[model samples]
Target: MSAEQGTHTHHDDRATVARHAVAADAAALDQAQRTASPIAGRAAGAPSGLDAAYATQHALIARRTDRGERVVGVKLGFTSRAKAEQMGVADVILGTLTDAMGVDDHGRYDPRTAIHPRVEPEVAYLLGPGVEDELAEPDPSASIAAVAPALEVIDSRYRDFRFSLDDVVADNASAAAFAIGPWRRPADTGPMDNRAVSLEFDGRLVQAGSTAAILGDPGRAIAAARRLAGRHGFALRAGMILLAGAATAAVPLPATGVVGAEIAGLGRVSLRVGDGARTEAR
Candidate 1:
């Protein structure tokens, strides 16, 4: 074979290998989600590089969509330095959020199907139409329809809630469920930075921090989401909700109790925890 032709063939072979790896990783994660079983992190059928991991992520989300789950938006993870340290991952990651993953404000969060669940406080953004274009400009505030105090319930599919960066990315950033509070116009919420954020379980404060922990300001998470989405070839659409990552390290979700999150100016949002599996809260 000619030198250039040989190089082209080598690239094609690598692409084929990555494609098969992505498919295998996606299928393993889908099985784990369905059976509520924890697979060995990275040690099992996980793709190697970030690119393959993201491809696996999209494939995993495709499985959910095939089963009738609509993609509602995207979520940024590891935006908080502390959360990244806790997870042993330094880079930021994004995950797909589907309609089936949302819980109404004040609704019950049943964790029966989760392997090990945790809850964290967050700032959420409601995006308007043409968000993709607006986010490309110097200031993207115009594309933000509203902001809210939010909570995310993350349940890693890996055993013991352990995984490497690529493993978690392929597993869709451990997205299990989420809740958002009342929406307030962006103009009314100030800059959405420096707001006191806290998570309470059964009326007791368990985790506390500030919105500033979310990539300096929660609004910055929106920009980060846009960039990550573009990198993954995912489009940001109108009426989509953007979770800006946790303000504090997540705490174990209770078995049967009210789990709430509050942002100083944005008000509070909560979910009633349901113990469908009779597993005790950690």
Candidate 2:
């Protein structure tokens, strides 16, 4: 039934159909995260447009906040042409980040709350005020206070990490957990777009790339974040962070293993996950 219907279905109107579709999709997503299990994607006639999908995602996050989860910041997706091509889309997307989705650096993370979790190294931005100005100039550093080596834990709510582009968008861009190393002043991590990053799993190099791959410059991703999120009444607040998308393809995170990353000059960041037998760390 449409959100307006408040109930009833079977021969539901188009608007009602969309409402029921979005509600079911959001419920499935929330349940997936709670049980750390994957679910099937939305059916072909469900909320399949980006605008409609994002509206559902925003509502999902709002429900979490109502339950006491504090918003921490935001993150960008499809920051590279390759990623856009892979997804059959041409625009980058933004997702909400929350304090509850953070794992301490150098500390243990619970692998129990994720289904086929994966990790990717990325450049993270610590925001300052006036980001709107920088976004206007298409220059992200002017509004960034610092940079850090970050690791993002992404868990697709869909089975086997399989989903259509719209499905992923509705799933909050696959965001899960995140950790960042010591923050460094812009002087140290100058020209973020050119930094080199590498990810090592259990001490073996697994993925590596340059930030340039992120929309030609990681900064542009931030600009995109500001513009896109602004439409939803979000502002670039100081102290907020922005995970500038993956530098390379994500690597499967094992139940028990060390995940570490290095950025050219931002220093190192890492997290450990114990045997998957545990269930409360999240």
Candidate 3:
């Protein structure tokens, strides 16, 4: 055969190898999920589970993509030092985007679909412009413009609501759904400044926290998010929602309960959890 023909054959072989690698990764993840067995970096005493977690998230994203779902954006979690400590980790993790994760402003969420669902009050940022460059410069302010108060609903498929950092990472940081509030434009305020927030369940106050709880300032969490995305060759884009991690510990959502969050400068967002709806455990 001619040299061009040999090159084509080599290319085909490489493509086949790549396909098998991807298939093997997917099969491993499927086995892990089914048997509740930790794989790769998720194993006990692993330094961090970021790799294993990202792999699993990528698998899920690929599956969604195969089903024709558009990826809207990414979400960051565990930015709060307190939360990291609570989860026994130092850094944050990322989750893939999906249309189904969006909840209507006043919609009801069922608790049956989630393995273990939990609620966290947070401040989310909607990128008005693309941050492709800023994601690499090691500073978050250059890429972000506005911020908003929001809540993240997280759930993990693992049993007992307990898992190692790698396990959680492999599980997409336990992110299930999110509810966002009105945008606080021109987030010129310092990224590290503290802002008070209150959460109410069924019209009664249940918890209160400060944005400072999240990596000293919610903006820093945004910066961390940008950095994390950069590591994965992705950028925070315009109109994409960036969840700056939870401001306080996540709360367990019981079936048939109404949840509300009020950020000092940002407005309020509320949602109802219904029976048969799935939720993450705190």
Candidate 4:
């Protein structure tokens, strides 16, 4: 083929690949939205297929980012060894952040938009300043200095609460929406390495755990978030809220329930989950 023809062919090939990637991403999002279980591989009988389902997830986040959606922060998942082993995965996964997914210190949420929704007691951190690329190493102290305590509300869009590691990763680490508590400055506490936490449902203690539940320390989770963001060509910014992985197994909320979580140093955040009810800020 002539030079001009070769150039045109290359451009066409690039376009075709881009189109396929976008289509795959959209289909994955649709499956999550519809609560449909995506085929494990390309086909029912096919042995080897897509190796990384989260690639489609990354594409979905990219599309949103391209559309001027600011990434508020990152979320860490599968931090506990027990949870990781149960999920049949060795390492944890990360998810991107969006403004629309955030809830105030005292806010409410609807259950209709989520599939297999559950609430996890966690310690969230708010970054004080942006962490640039060069300084993105896994420094727990520096990362912790940029963190604050809060809670996270997670809801999966998977059918029957069933999914493989790839499936969950593609579903944004099963994150639908999250709620933050009153921010507690890291400096206020002296060496909060392994503090204990408790979660109460309707004024009754439901679950208890420690910061050590998250990779020995919540700071490590923050470091993981930093590394993950850097790998994705992004940086953790000031005012960003990072939901460290769950301190304990997620507690499944019934259709109608009042949930509240209390961190050691941080204040408490409460929310009401209901079916077909609008979320009212408390």
Each candidate's number of clashing pairs is: 0, 1, 18, 0
Overall lDDT per candidate, in order of appearance: 0.85, 0.82, 0.69, 0.67
Choose 1 or 2, whichever is better by lDDT: 1
Q: Write the per-residue lDDT of candidate 2 for residues 1-282, one digit (tens) a residue.
A: 476565444435767878777877787788888888788776455666778888778767877888899888899988878878988887888888999998888878788888988999988889877575643664666778888889999999999899877788788899999999898888766677788888987777899898888888887876788888876555568789899899888888878878889888678898988754222232
- List of clashing residue pairs for candidate 2: 2-16
TM-score of every candidate relative to the true structure:
0.91, 0.87, 0.78, 0.80
Q: How far is candidate 1 from the true structure (C-alpha RMSD, Å)?
A: 3.4
The reply for model 4, stretches above 4 Å from the true place, is 1-22, 34-52, 62-69, 144-147, 275-282
Ranking by TM-score: 1, 2, 4, 3
Best by TM-score: 1
Candidate 2: stretches off by over 4 Å: 1-17, 43-45, 132-138, 232-235, 275-282
**Top-lDDT structure, candidate number:** 1
Q: After superposition, how far is residue 96 of candidate 2 from its true place, in Å?
A: 1.0
Instruction: Show where candidate 1 strays beyond 4 Å.
Output: 1-10, 43-46, 86-90, 275-282
Which of the two, 1 or 4, has more TM-score?
A: 1
